[model samples]
Target chain A: MKVTILGCYSATPRTFTNPTSQVLEVRNHLFLIDCGEGTQVQLRKYKIKFSRIKHIFISHLHGDHFFGLPGLISTFRLLGRESELHIYGPKGIKEAVTLFLKLGDSWTNYPLIFHELESKDTELLFEDDSVSVSTIPLDHRVYTNGFLFKEKPAPRKLDVKATTKHNIDRSQFNNIKNGANGKTANGVEVANQKLTLDPPNPKSYAFCSDTAYNETILPLIENVDVLYHESTFLESESRLCQKTKHATAKQAAQIAHKAQVGNLILGHYSTRYKSIDLFKEEALEVFPRVALADDGKSFDI
Target chain B: MKVTILGCYSATPRTFTNPTSQVLEVRNHLFLIDCGEGTQVQLRKYKIKFSRIKHIFISHLHGDHFFGLPGLISTFRLLGRESELHIYGPKGIKEAVTLFLKLGDSWTNYPLIFHELESKDTELLFEDDSVSVSTIPLDHRVYTNGFLFKEKPAPRKLDVKATTKHNIDRSQFNNIKNGANGKTANGVEVANQKLTLDPPNPKSYAFCSDTAYNETILPLIENVDVLYHESTFLESESRLCQKTKHATAKQAAQIAHKAQVGNLILGHYSTRYKSIDLFKEEALEVFPRVALADDGKSFDI
Candidate 1:
């Protein structure tokens, strides 16, 4: 799995910074997270294929998070895209987007589906054989939720050397790979453990943004292989963090540490500070495996 | 009066080019027109002061024409703007913008007023003593109207030397500037033209975009000091122009020539064109005084 950061600034777009937006590449699926204003331009700058985005997840209804969605959708239509697009976000998103399309008097040639999220509990939103997604309710000024993407375990691997030594028949190859014992024409029992090995553990990624420090999400994101958390302010602005219901760098690290995430990524820094080294330094105090997220940065999990 | 092109390309925002948007500086107001996607970023790149923009005019509801408005308004709120903002646009614009704000649960501290355009005839949408703006109905895929910003004839210049030679009292300057006959204490009359000369006929500017080749707008924009017209295609692509309800370069210049506009500014080039010089070349065939509008290029009217 690979993740790319298109933008990571708080509040508004600036000359050197942008609002929140990212891309997650997992199991041949490209998922867009929180398309902020200017996101279409950023996608072009990064050379990310526009048609590859089939799923979009919006954390909330803030302009900085989903303002670019309408433009992106319209561009897809202009480009003659025919694939279906699925959008999952809080309630009222469908109405807002529909109003834009209705006012413009232009409709997409492709199928556009919206999955409005209104539940306050963790609920499965998407699932396939290889991966699954669930929402983690977050504490914020408005309806917001963090998304958890978990990869399903792979199929059992065949131990070729062990199978050969055990004299496993060619007809039982499929059964052995499935960790099942198969009988031969001689009526002899073939043990599955002798021909198969355990599958590799799956990885998980969690995206959390525009939320206050809440321990309630720990269970949903616990032990995630990668954790992307918003760090809207530094320590100096800690007081404003609570008032605005935004997370500071230190607070994000505390959540990562408590959740025991493998790696913590901090982003969405405010434009007031020119340097982002302070956020990294503050976050590292709580979680040693913390890294600051920057625009165009890519991470492999 | 000065006009700056923020974006002129038609349809979609590209990596190096932008869609419809412009900044017109008349008197002391910085009027933003037709905010497409990524307009805020373009404004930042051009070093425009967002706060200086007190009014915004949206030509239509097409995504390429006005998708950036909500984001710009949200940014103003985030920046703690306290001044009132006036937006003039077609019907359904107010509800579209209000829906976005309500969904985000974010309200602006500043007063935001929307003047929804519902008239098919030429009507004054915005005006003051120094400048007046009227709508020019155009043929397009949707209900749209172009804007004509005419600078009111400046206060007739008081010819100080002529006034002194005529022995006019300084206290009568106001009456002379207002084109009124000066009444003297001894029942004497002073002709206004003898004391004052007309100020350099106040400049006028007309903006027409996303419209097909139609001569109906000529009368409304006739004899304007400067006219910015959309040329979305070349003569070779004139077929597409008609099919898409857009104008070609030659078509735009034809209107400019027929209307006897002082200067013809051609823009909204299609992305298929490699260079903008072709638009000027094509327009010059019909109108000699034609120039291609480039992003960030400023023109003094």
Candidate 2:
């Protein structure tokens, strides 16, 4: 799995920094998360194929989180796209987007579907044969959610030498890979464990942002391969974090340490700070495996 | 009067080119016309002060014309702007913008006033002591209007030498500048023309875009100092122009010639064209003075 950060600044986009938005590539699906303003231009700058974005997941209704959605959808129509697109966002997303498109008389030519989310509990949002996505309810000024993406376990690998030694026919290889016992021509049974080996562990990623420091999401994001959390301010400005319902670097580290995730990624830095190194330094006090998220940066998990 | 082209291309914004948007500086007011997507970034890139903009005039409801408005308004709030902003656009603008802001719960602290328009006849949209703006109804697929900004004749300039020779009292200078006859100390009447030369011919700028090849607007824009007309296609694609309700380069030139404007500016070129010089060349065939509008290019009238 690979994730690309298109933008990660807080509040409004500026001359050199962008708002919250990212693209995650997992299980052959390219999913867009939290499309902020100027995301389309950033996508062009990063050379991400616009058509590859089949599904979009918005965390909340903040302007910095979803202001770019309407423009992106209009660009798709202008580019003559025909593929169906699915959008998963908050309840009022459809109404807001529909009103804007209706006023402009710019309806899409393709099938556009919206999956409005209103659940306040951890619930499944999307699922396929190889991947599944669920929401992590978060505490904020408005209704918001974090997303958890996990890859499904693959089929067991076949042990060719062991299968051949057991006189298993080639036609029975499919059954062995499916975790079933293989039978020889003589009607002797071969145990499934003897004929195949366990597959590698599946990978998982979690994204949390625009939320206060809360331990309620720890259970849902526990043991994730990579966890991205918003650190809008430093410990020095923790008071602002409390007032705005945003997280500081120290709080984000505490959450990562409690969840025991493999790696922690910090993003959504406030523009007030001249340097981002302070966030990492503050986070390192609690969690050693922490990385900074920067625009146009790519991570491999 | 000075005009700056923020984005002049038709349809969608690309990696290098932007959609329809411009900044006109006339009579101490920085008026933004047709804010397309990514306009805020373009404004920052061109170093246009955000606070200097007090009025925004949208030509139509097309996404390419006004998609960036909501984000721009939200940014103003984030920057702690306290001044009132006036937006002039089609009737549905208020509902559309209000819905988007309401969904995000991001209401602006500044007073936002909207002047919704649905008139089919020429009407004055804005006016003050020094400048006046009127709408030029245009033929298009949607309810659209072009704007004509005219600088009111300045208080007639005082011909200091002539006034002194006429022995006019200093206190009567104000009356002479106001186009009144001046009285000398001996009760001699001095003609207004002799006391003051006619204020430099009031400069005017007409902005017409996203319209078909119609001559109805010529009377409203006639003899203007500078006229900006949309040329979305070349003469070869004139057929497409009729089908799309757009004007060709030749058509724009024809209007300029008939209207007898001081200078003709061509913009809103289709992205399919490889060279914009073709538009200037074709327009120059019908009009002698023609200028091409490019992003970041400025014009002084």
Candidate 3:
């Protein structure tokens, strides 16, 4: 899976900093997460094929998280898109988007399917042959959900050398990979372990933002290949962070460490600090494998 | 009066080109016109003071015309703006904006007043000590209006030297400025022309956009000092322009010439062209002294 960070700053989109938006490219699918203002422009800049994004997941209704939704929808209409677009967002997203389209008298010619989410449970939102998505309940000022994307395990790899030595027939290869033991046409018992090797490990990614330090989400996101957590403040502003229901750098690192993720990505820095180095320094002290997310940066997991 | 063009291109906002947006500064009031996407960033890049903008006028509901409005409102709220903001637009504007705010659950601390407009004839929309604004009905894909900003004639310019020569009493200065015959204590009548001059010609500016080549607005914007009209196409694309309810450069110039305006500014060019010089070249054929507006360019009328 490849993760591209469109923007990472918290609060608002400014002349220099943009709000939250990212793209997760898994297999042939492009999943857009949290489209903030200027997201379409960013997509254009990054040369991302916006029409390929069939699914969009919004964490909440904050301006910084989903303000660019209407513009994106309008752009799709302007471009004459005909494919169905699925949007998974908070409960009121349908009303908001529908009102905009109604007022403008500009509705999409394509199918616009909205799945309103109001529950605070690990509900599956999307699943295909290769991947599945679920929500991770989080603590925030309003209803918000963190997304977990897991790539399903692949079929067991074939031990080519052993299979050749054992004369495993090509037609029986599928059964061997499926861990099925069967007798050969010569009445010889061919064990599946001798014919197939272990498959490559599956990868998973989790996204969390605008939330307080809640331990409940650790288990759902634990052992993921990558975890992106909002680090809106540093330890110096920890008091204000909790009061605002936002997490500090140290708190984000602590969660990542407890979850035992392979790599932790910290983002959504507040504009109060000119330098984001303090966040990296603080997070590194707690979780050594932490990296600060910069706008337009991409991570391969 | 000063008009700053924040953006002038038609259709979607691109990284290199923006959509329609302008700032009309009359006396102490800063009026914003047609906020498209990236307007806030344009405002910041142009160094326009946000707090000074007391009123915003939207010409239509097209995304290219007013997509940036909600973001600007949210930014103002985040910046702690307390003064009321007056938005004048079509009838459905209030519903669209309210729905966005409701979904975000972000209410502004400041008063947001929407003066929804629905009229087929000339209607007064704003007035102050120095200027007044009236709407000019426009023909477009949707209900649209062009704005006419006329500066109330300045207190007739005082011909101080002429007044002194005419021996006008200081107490009668006000009367002379109002084009009245000033009478001295000795019953000597001073001619008004001898004491006062014409009031700086009473400059007026009209903004006409997203409209076809219609003659109905000529009378409303007649003899204005300056006119800013949308010229989405050159003469070569006049047929397509008419189908889209947009004017060609020649058409804009024809309107300006028929209205007998002092200067004509053509804008809202389609991005298909590599340059805007063709618009000016085509417009000048019908009406000389035509200027093509560019993003971040300014015009003083």
Please name the candidate that would achieve the greatest DockQ relative to the true structure.
1
| iRMSD (1 decimal) for each model | 0.9, 1.2, 1.2
lDDT of 3 by residue, A44-130 (tens): 888999889999999998888988888899989988899999999999899988877777788889999999999978899999889
* lDDT score for residue A10 of model 1: 84
lDDT of 3 at B59: 91
**Model 3 chain B weakest lDDT span, ten residues long:** B193-202
Ranking by lDDT: 2, 1, 3
Native-contact fraction for each model? 0.90, 0.60, 0.48
lDDT of 2 by residue, A1-301 (tens): 8999999999887778899999999978999999998899899999999899999999999889998899899888989999989999999999988888888788999989999999999889899999999999988888899999999998889999998899999999887888889999899998999998878889999999889998999999999999999999998999897678999999999999999999999999999999998999999999999999999999998
Error of 1 at B195 (Å): 4.1
Q: Which segments of candidate 2 are over 4 A away from where they belong?
A: A161-169, A183-188, B169-171, B183-187
Q: Candidate 1: deviation at residue B75, Å? A: 0.9
Model 2 alpha-carbon miss at residue A46, Å? 1.6
Q: Say which candidate scores most in TM-score.
A: 2
Tell me the tens digit of each residue's lDDT in model 1 across A246-283: 99999999999999999999998988887999999999
By TM-score, rank the candidates, best first.
2, 1, 3
Angstrom error at residue A175, model 3: 4.9
* Residue A139 C-alpha lDDT in model 1: 89
